[model samples]
Structures are given as structure tokens and as C-alpha cells.
Target: MDTKSLIIEKATILFQQKGYKSVGLTEILKACNVTKGALYHHFPNGKEQLLIACLQVLNEVIMTDIESIFRRHLSTKEALLSIIDKLIRDLETEGTITGYTFSSIVSEMATVSEPVRHACSALYENIQQIYSAKLVTDGLSNESASAIALLMTASIEGAMMLCLTQQSSDPLKTIAKLLPKLLKDI
Candidate 1:
């Protein structure tokens, strides 16, 4: 990868593991094996700028993957099931989950950092929009579909956290069963 991409890539992993506020520019520079001057050359504003870029990079990757899953021409329920299955498989393979979820990170930083808060909000809104679109395609009224989509997203995030905290995949399995039941109401 190019230097800029390398910096972003390294920053993404660090931010995911340590969160935005906890990580420092020196650490990121050392992790990337780049000089402070090189980091400044790419991210003049330093850590915050790099954090925003990291958020943007992660948001794009996640949104693209979600969109691709939703675009598989399945019913919304099936599409959602596919996503959950993918998540389970991924978690199993990775052994541990890393990454700052938009909601969790926002809640952690919102009181102190407006810019990061807004970035997290924007990422969530983008995800919600994608979910809403999928819900609409599944035949619910726009308002109801959007509401349900938001709830599902919130629930899934919660489940993921619980699963991660317990070092058990049971939460994922529970959601896999519950999600289909919830969708029947839609």
C-alpha cells in the first residue's frame, strides 16, 4: 500500500483496539513505522484527523459490505439472516472482535469530543439508511420499516457486545433465532 493508505490502515487497527481518545500520534507513528513528520505530512491535524479518516475508512467498508448483503435479491428477512450468519462466521474465525462500534464509541466520547461524536452519528445514519431501504424493499411502510430497522440494528449491536464480553457466541445464536421471529411481525 501507499504511505497514506498504510497510515490509515495501521491507524484503523489501533483505533479499533484502543479507541480514538486513548491512542496517541506517537503510537500510531511507531505502529506504522513512519516518522512523526510523515504522519504530519499526511494528517496535518494529527490524531483527530487520522481518527476521522479511520472512521471514514471503516464506515465505507462496513456500509459497502452491508449494501452488498442487502442487494442479494433475497427478501429482507433472508438478507438479514445472511448478515447474521456472516457475523457469526466472522466472529468465530477472528476469535475476538475488535473495532469501535459507532454507538458505543459515540456514547464514550460524545461528552468530550464533538467531531468524533458527529462522525459516529454520520456512520450510524448511513447504516440506518441502508437498513431502511432494505426494509422498504421487504414491503413494510416506510415509517414502520425504518423504525424496525433501527431496532434490529440496535439489538444486533447489543447482542454482539454481549457475546464479545462473555467470550461466548450464544448471543449471536439467540439473535439468529429471535431475528426471524421479529421479522414475522414486519
Candidate 2:
């Protein structure tokens, strides 16, 4: 990764773990091992801009993964399970069960920063649309698909939080088991 991306990547982890208010520029610089001059060279607006840049990078990565998963799976349920499985594995391996950037950022900075809030909202809406489209393709009406997709997204995020809070992956696995039932009647 380049200097900017390297900074963002390190900052992303710190921000996710500590929240926007708690993570300082010095900490980000140290984590990234970049000088203040280098950070300002890439992010002239300072920490806020760096946070937004990190969100944008996250948005791109998530959208790309969504597209790839949708392309690889033939059914909505399969795609959903695949996503949940991937999350389970990630949580198991990285122990980043609590490292959801959107949840962390929005809860801390949404009221203070319009750009950061909007970037987070756009990512969530795009993710919802990805899930909704798959459900529509699986024969549900747009309205039903959209509604279920919203529920699924909320449930998944909540389940992830539970996994972190409880310090176990059981909550995620339980959510995964109940997921198929959400689409069964449709």
C-alpha cells in the first residue's frame, strides 16, 4: 500500500477499536509509523479527512465483496450464508468481532461530522441494496425483498455486536441458523 492507504489502514484499526474521539493523530501516526508531515501531505484537512478516507476505502472493499459474493452464489440464502460464514471465520481468526468501522464511527462522530456520517450512511444503503437485489432475484417483490434485506442487515450487525460482547461466536452461528427462515415464506 501507498503512504495514504497505509495510514488509513492503520488508522482504520485504531479508530474501530478506540472510536473517533479517543484516537489521536499522534497515535495514528505512530501506528502507521508516518511523520506528521507525511500525514498532512496526504490528508490536509487532518484527522476528519483521514477518517473519511478510511470510510471510503472500507466502502469500496465491502461493495466489491458484496458483488463478488452475489456473483458466486446462485441463491439469496446461499449468498447470505456465505457472508455469515465469512464473518464467522474472520471473527475466529482476527478476533475483530468488535471492529466494525461503521458501527464504531457512526456512534461516535455521526452528530459531529456530516461528511463522515454521509459516508457511513451511503455504505449501509449500498449494502442493503445489494442484499435486496438478491432477494428480488430470488422471486420476492421489491418491497418485501427490501424489507427483509433491512432486517437481515440489522440482525447481522447486532449479532456481530453480541459476538463481541459475549466473546464467543455462538451468537453469530445462531443468527446464521435463523437466517434461512427469514426467507422461507417468501
Candidate 3:
């Protein structure tokens, strides 16, 4: 991979394990085996720039995956259920949902860093839009579809957080079961 991509790959792991503020340039440099000068050459603004790059990379990967899921021939509800199942499987493999999410980092840095906050916010909005479009295509009214998409997204995020903190998949399964019934109303 190129230096910039390498930096982002390594930083994603570090930031996921150790919040943005806790992981410094030295740690990221050491992990990537890149010198301070090399890091600066690729990211002139230092750690902040690197963090933003990591967020962008993550956002693209996740949004693309979600979009592809929707684009599949599966029904909208099936696609949504598949997303939850995939997330559960990923968490089981990763041991922590944090690795698959930048939400924790956004929560930590949002108040202090406007750029990071905006990057995270934009990612979330994209996700909601994707789901809203799918729901509308599935026959729900635009307003109801949008609202349901937002609600379901928020619930999934919350369920993931709970499962991660509790170190149990039961919460995930519980939420999965609840999701279908919840969608019945929409």
C-alpha cells in the first residue's frame, strides 16, 4: 500500500483500540514503522489530518458495504436483517464492535475537533440516506421511510454499543428479533 494508505490502515486499529486523543503521532509512527518526517510528508497537519483520513477511509468502506447490501436483490427488510446479522458476526470475530466503528472516536473528538465531527456526521447521514432510499423503494412513504431508517440505525448503534460493553451477543440477538416487529409498523 502507499504511505498514506498504510498510515490509515495502522491508525484505524490504533484509534479503535485507543481513542483518538490517547494515541499520539509517535505511537502511530512506531506502529507503521514510518519516521516523523515521513508521516508529515504524507500528512502535513500531523495527527489530526491522519485521524480525518482514517475516518474517511472507514466511512467509504462502510458506506460502500451498506450500499452494496441494499443493491442486492434481497427485499428491503431482508437486506436490513442481513446487515444486523453481519454486524453480529463481525463483532463475534473482532471481539469488540469498536474496531468496526468510528462512533466511539467521534464521540470522543466531536466536541474538540470540528473536522472529525463533520466527517463522522457526514458518514452517518449517508448511511441514513441509503436506508431511507431502500425503504422508500420498498413502498413506504418518504417521510415514514426516512424516520424508520433513522430510528432503526440509532437502535442498531445502541444495540452494538451495549453488546460490546456487555461482552455478550444476547443483546444483538434480542435486537434482531425486535427489529422485524418494529418494521411491521412502518
Candidate 2 worst ten-residue window by lDDT: 96-105
Ranked candidates (lDDT, high to low) = 2, 3, 1
The lDDT of each candidate is 0.79, 0.86, 0.84
Q: What TM-score does structure 2 among the candidates reach?
A: 0.94
TM-score of each: 0.92, 0.94, 0.94
- Candidate 3 on 1-186: residue-level lDDT in tens? 888899999999899877898998889999999999999999999888988999888888888888888888456678888888888888888787654567678779999999999988988888889988988887899998899889878878788778877888777788789877866654
Tell me how far the alpha carbon of residue 32 in candidate 1 is from the true structure, in angstroms, after superposition.
0.7
Query: Can you list the residue pairs that collide in candidate 2?
Result: none
Stretches off by above 4 angstroms in model 3 are none
**Candidate 1 Cα misplacement greater than 4 A, ranges:** 99-104
User: In terms of TM-score, how similar is model 1 to the real structure?
Assistant: 0.92
TM-score of 3: 0.94
lDDT of 2 by residue, 1-186 (tens): 899889999988888878889999999989989999999999999999999998988888888988899889998888989988888988899887434436878888889989999999988898899999999999999999989989988888888877877778888899899988877765
- The CA lDDT at 41 in model 3 is 97
Backbone clashes in model 1, listed as residue pairs = none
